[model samples]
Target: MSNEDQYGGGVGSGYGEVGGTGQTRTRLPDAPSDPYGTPRRAPRASRGLVTVVGVVVLLIAAIAFANQSSDSPRTPADQTPPAATSTSATGTRPVDGKNGAIPKGFAHDEQGAQSAAANYAVALVSADILKPQMRRQIVRQVFVADKVSELEARLDQAYGKTFLDQAGLDANGNAAQGLTYISRTVPVGTKAAKNSESTTTVDVWCTGVFGTAGVGSTNPVSNDWFTMTLTLRWAENDWKVESFAQKDGPAPVHTDRTASTAEEIAKAATEFGGFTYAR
Candidate 1:
């Protein structure tokens, strides 16, 4: 069969047929002429068509402009929102459980990933990481089961004698008799670089204090800024750390604020305990 016949657009369909000279096609009346042989006025049909075309073109341009805008206010004509409301529907789900001091059971979505990253950033840099037993606990609680052993071993090696000494802590991760070793991390904000059903990568921006705080201390506590990027896997109905890396931050400019005394710093750190952060 012919291609046209097979596809059902056979001959005599008039798809490509052209009118011949003998066809009685209707024509618009010629424009009117003046007695003085002046140029005739364009046809009423032609003028009416130009006006219609202009209005249609204007309408199309207006619609295109409205659609191209990034910051337009939503209206009835706006595109429909996502079907799943996710975090918004939950309205900051309260974190009511903890594995020791670390918050657990995040929401399993973007908000949950961000909260996990922020909380884990605190655990990663807190004074507890300097202590062997506490470090192991933190690793097990905040990290994936497969990574717990590896992270514990790595942390043990990293927080050896020299490392502790630099931070004014002893082999047991304790400060000298008169000084207090203060290490604390405050998460400023969190952003999820990637979030899916099974995995999430989050960046937590933080400021922290590290070093000994006391009269005549060699390394008095000082503030530093950093960003921790954590990759989390959704395992056992919770977001657990698979891996984490940190880098010096997008820090704000420092003010020439008067420095507090080491004694005052130690007193404040002790008096004002940390918080359990939420989204």
Candidate 2:
């Protein structure tokens, strides 16, 4: 079955355009205009324009809400000097059940490293890095010397012909007309599974939507769960992803939102861009 069939469609939202009933009318003027046309009257604004404006407003409001809801910028409470009960020196910690696995960047010293791992994982699986040339560049920049060649070869094979075909793309990985290819990992949380002065083992558990959403598309957007275990060697002031692996879900309960039409999903995917995660 396709991703849509398995996950019930689209990423956070499902497939299918939302439909609503609206009245249409033809207005008749009292009299015909002269040759000059009495200075052509301005047409009334379209319902579509009104809808677009409303959507923009809502999006702004939503973003504002999210920002306000974020934790304060001051030093995190966990960063305060540890109490007698505290077992770890670095107070920064991951919340239980936030992500499926342990968090990253617990020690105050390793926050940068943890951020690097999270960002690297985001880059690794992003649709942007799927292109062979780009993937190579990313691997070279982010991976350690020992693993670059092996990872490059493996990723090339993994994103090979069969994978493209399954994703409804050509060997080059471009989406067919009217289709949007989606492959992005959003870090749900990060934690330090193990740590030391020189090396830190961080786990970044992510939930993402991947696949294609389009009319008559074979691969539709769907949800996926994966944990990325990263071993970092404090290198050049950043925590680079020394190695990583993926294991499927501890998925959450589903919501009752209506699925959107394939067309809508495709449009949204195209219109919106993904983000670069940070710790």
Best by TM-score: 1
Native-to-model Cα distance after best TM-score fit, residue 214 in candidate 1, in Å: 0.6
The regions of model 2 sitting more than 4 angstroms off are 1-108
Candidate 2 lDDT, 160-201, residue by residue in tens: 564344345666657787777665556776666667767776
**What local lDDT score does residue 241 receive in model 2, on the 0 to 100 scale?**
49
What does the lDDT read for residue 270 in candidate 2? 71
Root-mean-square deviation (CA) per prediction: 31.5, 20.9
Q: Give candidate 1's TM-score.
A: 0.67
Best by lDDT: 1
Lowest summed lDDT over 10 consecutive residues: which window, candidate 2? 20-29
What TM-score quantifies how close candidate 2 is to the native fold?
Answer: 0.59
